[model samples]
Target: MSTKPSLAVVERLYLADAMGAPLQARLRLSLCAGQGIVGDRHAGRRDWPGQNLTLVEAEEIENYCLSRSRPIDLALTRRNIVTRGVRLNSLVGRRFRIGDCLLYGIERCEPCRNLGQRLADETFDVPAVIHYWTGRGGLRADVLSDGAIRAGDKLEIVDTSGGLA
Candidate 1:
């Protein structure tokens, strides 16, 4: 059977401990990007294509951050994509096709001290998750087609070459 990976829109997107310019997000959660369209808000540099986490990571981080009264919440993050049914870690080295765009599985979304602070508990295995997912957190893909991507868009695993690597 094929791994049916699907995407969804969550009620919230969050940015933990972000103290710089406000990021822009869409309530739609997913957006369609066509040729010449900007695929990521922060695309370029080492953090190209940006980092995105699954709902699971967000929930875990939210609980940890909220307990510590940290300032990481949906209102703060403007993530363009919120995925469901797809584990951020499991996608490592895999190839994902969303609409006409393609992405390479890169890494996981790790929790930072900012996340711990946002939780207000300051006591969680934030480091462990981070360490495990570093460089393997979130799938980072170079724009393949720049097609319009929107919330509820379907993600297809076109290639399984990720596991071999």
Candidate 2:
């Protein structure tokens, strides 16, 4: 894999009151270390560690649409940040910065039945949703610093080691 610091821009930001709830688009969001997006349903919930934030690439959605012959809503994915130009999968176990906030990629945010259930009404093939997003769902991250992130913010890979880690 290439060690070059991957660069991307935040394309969209979303938040919701609770799990499985419709997402609300935001131009900006406040995040805290050890907590998720401030005011988000999962914020401060320790039950699921490393779930402080979730990210999905816009390209993934495009690819899914092309492969499935249907369009999927970004909000339905339940990811906090929708990015463009960054390979989120490669960031797993790495540290990255979005705006002023620092985040550590914890794991792949694999698609789950819950996501399928949420799209049940709008989609006729829920399994397809799961299938398409299985490994491309996105990445789960833990906030390392408190700060504000906004749409159009640039993403930068942080060098944790003396060189790329």
Candidate 3:
């Protein structure tokens, strides 16, 4: 099986620096950069630097995207960065090249209890047990390039650092 990152598209987009914030309910998932993608929805936080993933957990995001009905152009979060066509979890312990930027994948983004609360559906248990999630879903990447990322930009995995076995 080929182990490459994939993308999943959503009919709607949601953004917010904080839970229950106006930014949460008002954001749209349309194809837009700067205002939506590649920037920080939660820039000021010392914990989360860029936009984060919401629906798909880190290890499972790519798989979820692959099985999705339509091709998702990008996945944007409350964090500062936007990812396109790249599965964040698959890049764990690997380095991704986006233009002049090179980001190192740290770990899988497990889902949080907050997700269950936010979703109000509590369907995370099934995926979590399958190793698709750990509880909170998302990823953590250190910024290599300080520029804006859009939907069409290419995401290349340069090195796996003994990863992707």
Candidate 4:
């Protein structure tokens, strides 16, 4: 983590109602711990944590757009939350909170090459896409507490000690 991670704000929120459906931007999301976001397509599919929530850095998205020299929508990243002012990768294995929801960062949300092909333009190719989103994709987290989170809500690191029982 070269960049010092700090408090972040949820810059954008999105949800997909069904498989392969387009991401719909939302002002707020009702999250169910261990069940995922209410009404979201992937909500009840997982019987575990890790994937209950997904977040991507707005800054990284900006960097990718700059590298590709084209404006890409945040929704296309397919992450549940878009955070500003934090290095999300640094949060892996740490406990954080957005609104009243507590979450454990399980792993890095790696880039998808298929989405890369779609994002790639004439000048930039798939290789460039991989190069850009390799480590900057986002985060996959396990929700620890059920709560509602809004787009403008603050994301704070509540525990970095790995949540000792």
Off by over 4 Å in 1: 1-19, 27-41, 47-80, 121-141, 163-165
- Scored against the true structure, residue 152 in model 1 reaches a CA lDDT of 49
Model 4 C-alpha lDDT per residue in residues 76-156, reported as the tens digit of each score: 688999999878888888989999899889888887787688778787788887777888889889878899999899988
Please provide, for model 3 over 55-95, each residue's C-alpha lDDT reduced to its tens digit, 9 standing for 90 to 100.
23322334544444334333422333344444566766776
C-alpha TM-scores of all predictions: 0.54, 0.85, 0.51, 0.87
Sliding window of 10 residues with minimal summed lDDT for model 1: 28-37
The TM-score that candidate 1 achieves is 0.54
Whole-model lDDT values for every prediction: 0.44, 0.84, 0.43, 0.84
| Model 3 stretches with alpha carbons more than 4 Å out | 1-19, 22-41, 48-87, 122-132
* Clashing pairs counted in every model: 27, 0, 17, 0
- Name the lDDT value of residue 125 in candidate 3: 55
lDDT of 2 by residue, 1-165 (tens): 879755699999999978657789999999999898998988998777577999999988777665656676666577999999887878887888999899998888888888777555455577876776788889899999999999999999895442211
| Alpha-carbon lDDT of model 4 | 0.84
